[model samples]
Target: MFSGAQISLYPMADDFVSVIMAALTGLDPWREALRIETDDISTLLVGPPEVLFAAMRDLFVRAAQTGVHCVLSAAVSRGCPGEPDDPICMAQGGFARDLALPDRIAAARANVGLAAVTGQDVAAQFSLYPLGEGPHMDEIYGCIDFLKASGTFDRSKNFCTRLRGDAGPVFATLCEAFTNFGTVAGHVVLDVTVSANSPSAR
Candidate 1:
């Protein structure tokens, strides 16, 4: 399977460059585990779900810690038919496609409950797309049920779901949403945006 994310970070401050550069150091721990490439537009991180989400969380938290409003936009995907399989994308444990919907929801919830607390409050909105066929709506509804019980769930919007809470569970919830709803070996994508320290919240 090939899993990766194209992410862009935006910091609302005059010294955005400094904030971005400092926040990037958070990826150092995950560099060895992921194939990382950065350019003017966005950074591409190719790796397993665990390392991928954690690295993103750390980076975003670091930026938010500076008390500057920060937003992280990510297009996360796994098992894309067009992408070749990569060894770095191998994950240790994951739900099987054959698992029942209820089982998957339970597992996803349990995983989110285990997420560490980062103490950084954030709000996020995202849409999960389980590509290909086979009960797509069912999978989407099941994911929605999980989100409602995820503790971080804020509300349901027109085209996406909103989540708000500490960065840890919020990001963990995003990871589970990306990994659990779709077919294990099928194409799945998540369009996510996370924000912290936004003036609008005040």
Candidate 2:
């Protein structure tokens, strides 16, 4: 299986460059575990789900901690048919593919419950796509059920769901939503945008 994310970070400040560069240090701990490549447009992180989401959380939190409004946009995907299998992408202790939908939902919730608290408040909205054949809506609705009970769920929007809470649980929730639904070897994608310190919130 191959898993990765294309992410872009925006800092609402004049010194955006400095903020982004400094915040990149947050990925240091995860570097050995992930393949990180940066370009002018976005950064690509290829790795296991556990390390992937944590890296994103750390990077975003570091930027937000600069007291600047920061937004993180990510296109996360796993098991893309077009991508070759990568040994480094192997994950440990994830829900089995044959698990019932309800069972997966429960496991996802339990995973989110153990997330580390980062104490950084953030708002996020995301859409999960379980591509390919199978009971897609059932999977989505199951994800919704998990989200409603996630303690971070804010509301349901037109094409996405919103969540608000400390960065830890919020990111954890996103991670579970990404990993739990859909066939384990099927293509799955998640579109996410997370914001902190936005002037609109103040």
Candidate 3:
């Protein structure tokens, strides 16, 4: 599968540079796992869905911990049928990617020590889209079912869910959804917008 994300971070503070630096520095550990390129506008991360989302979780959480009111905008896509994957994406196939998800989540949990003024909760909205010629709606429902059953869902919110404690497990669930949908139904894409320490903060 060909997966990539174009992400831009907005740190709401006077010293935005430091906040951004902290977040980018956090990603250094995942550099070996992902292919990252940062330009003026946004950073492009290309790799498997699991690694890409996991890295995003780690990077965004670290940035938000600066207490600078950070908002991350990411357009993530995967499982493009005929699209040619970058070298980094192709290079990820040798190892067992499934086993790595749990390890990544554990690593993320150990790193998060920042206390939030409101509380340490992560919320996200996801729209899973299944492509290609098949029963896409069924696959989409299956993924959503998995998400809801995981006990992390806030069904009251429209197109959104909240993870009250560790962001790692929430991300792990998302990665599972992406992996399952794509592997079973073929081409799939997930449109996600995640926020940590959101403005509402209730």
lDDT of 2 by residue, 31-67 (tens): 9889988888999999998889999999999999998
Candidate 2: which pairs clash? none
TM-score of each: 0.98, 0.98, 0.76
Q: Rate the local accuracy (lDDT) of all candidates.
A: 0.93, 0.93, 0.64
Q: Mind giving the per-residue lDDT tens digits that candidate 3 earns over 135-162? A: 6766556555556555456663465444
Worst 10 residues of 3 by lDDT: 110-119
Model 2 spans > 4 angstroms off: none
Model 3, residue 148: distance off in Å is 1.0
What ranking of all candidate models by lDDT puts the best one first?
Answer: 1, 2, 3
Please identify which of the two predictions, 2 or 3, would achieve the higher lDDT against the true structure.
Answer: 2
Model 1 ranges with Cα > 4 A deviation: none
Q: Which residue ranges in model 3 land beyond 4 Å of their true spot?
A: 90-120, 156-165, 183-185
